[model samples]
Target: MDGSQGRKTRQVVAAIAAGGKVGRQKDLLACGHSEWSLRQAVKAGMIMRIAPGYYALPDADPLDLHLARHQARKTCFSKAAELGLWILNPVPQPHVAAAHGRPVPGCKVHRVKGGQTLMDILRQCVGCGSELEALAVLESAVVLKQCTVHELRTAFSRRGDGAARAVIAMIDPQSQSIVETAARYLLKKVGYNVQGQASVWGVGHLDLLVEGILGVELDGEKYHNTPEGWAEDLRRDNLLVINGVWKLRIPAAVVLYNPDLMLLWVERALDRIETASPR
Candidate 1:
């Protein structure tokens, strides 16, 4: 092999690796590598053919390779979840935006331009998932300060009246976790007056207050798994009970995995409270 040809191959690999470990036949051609060089690189196991026009390094990210193979870009909940924004459901299929309309076997195509903005993704996401699921991602984005409320409101304002607008009206940047968002959603769905992050005179702030009487606390492992944390929680629970506020602390796993059971418990508690209260 000529030393210059070998150097060119290495340079191409480095370039592709830097650019998300994927490239195309046209990319190699633009980088001054001949068709013969691409064939040699594939034959030598330097890269793998992702599709007719795309190639990826051997150690490329699986999701990136999948995107390149289908000539699509991740969008909606898919992009939001990947960016560490909260989402309720694990995406059943890869949500992709592509110029072509041909159905890809395992992906949900948005059938548009590939480069979608965060606002664009949010607009699509609200229509794609359940109301709660959509709010979870939207509220998470706001709470994390990924997108400001003003920015989201401005985006929705351009789209006019629809589910996206309804979801925008429901956006609460106060929700700290998907569990909390789900909890608040479930309570409101059942006709309870749910206040998120409600504060007590001595208690600072609680996760939720339902019907102005019941306190619902969402406990995640990171904050509640320690003995000191456990003791402090018990103290808080005792204090709430003393102040005529009954408390129910829901574990994060229970809220996330068995939400219906938690909701059932909540409804039953609400029913009992209503039964006991004077009309």
Candidate 2:
């Protein structure tokens, strides 16, 4: 490619990369690339025409190409998962947001304007999923500092967002992971006063403190499988016992999948603590 042609190619490449490695023909044209330049670039294998109006790098993500073809962007659970949020259940198909376009086959479509924000995704999540699922995503965003509780509450304060606002009220940013959020939500729903990341004198922060006595620690194997992690947890458990705090250590999976069993255990432990203490 000559100097002028090379500059044009670089411009097109930069445009596509800027658009998450996928650009529409009109977008490239708006970026000062002519039809002749685009055609030449495609012919020279500089960029691939994934769809009629879409141009992407040859190795662009298939999902991006698919979304580009349908003029949609990820939203709801799909976008939540993409943003590394805590997703309790995985959807079978991608969920996308689009204002006006033919629905992408095998994908959930949420009618939303172009250039949707993280708040938009959260609003869509609240509208689309169950309360628990929505809470998980919201808590994930808050804990990650992606958004704030105030921002969310304000965003959902509009008319017709009563349900979304209700879900936003349930967000606990202190719940570190999805498992902790689920456990806390379940406990709260059953009328337990659940406190997340409650600090004890010696134990620092417990995953949850129910009724001010029972320390429920949700342990994911990823963090506890190592010998050092196991020893540290044991040390914390010992400190809790010394401080008159009863500890209930449950696997993260139990909180996610077998919540009933976890609840039963909690009830039983609380009962034991109550029975043993002189009321």
Per-model CA lDDT versus the true structure:
0.82, 0.88
lDDT of 1 by residue, 44-127 (tens): 788888898788899988887878877876788888887888988898998988888667668898888645678888888887
lDDT of 2 at 142: 92
C-alpha lDDT of candidate 2 relative to the true structure: 0.88
TM-score of each: 0.78, 0.91
lDDT of model 2 at residue 50? 79
The C-alpha local distance difference test score for the whole of candidate 1 amounts to 0.82
**Candidate 2 per-residue lDDT over residues 133-211, each given as its tens digit:** 9999988999999989999888888899998888888887677888999999999999999999999986799999999
Residue clash pairs of candidate 1: none
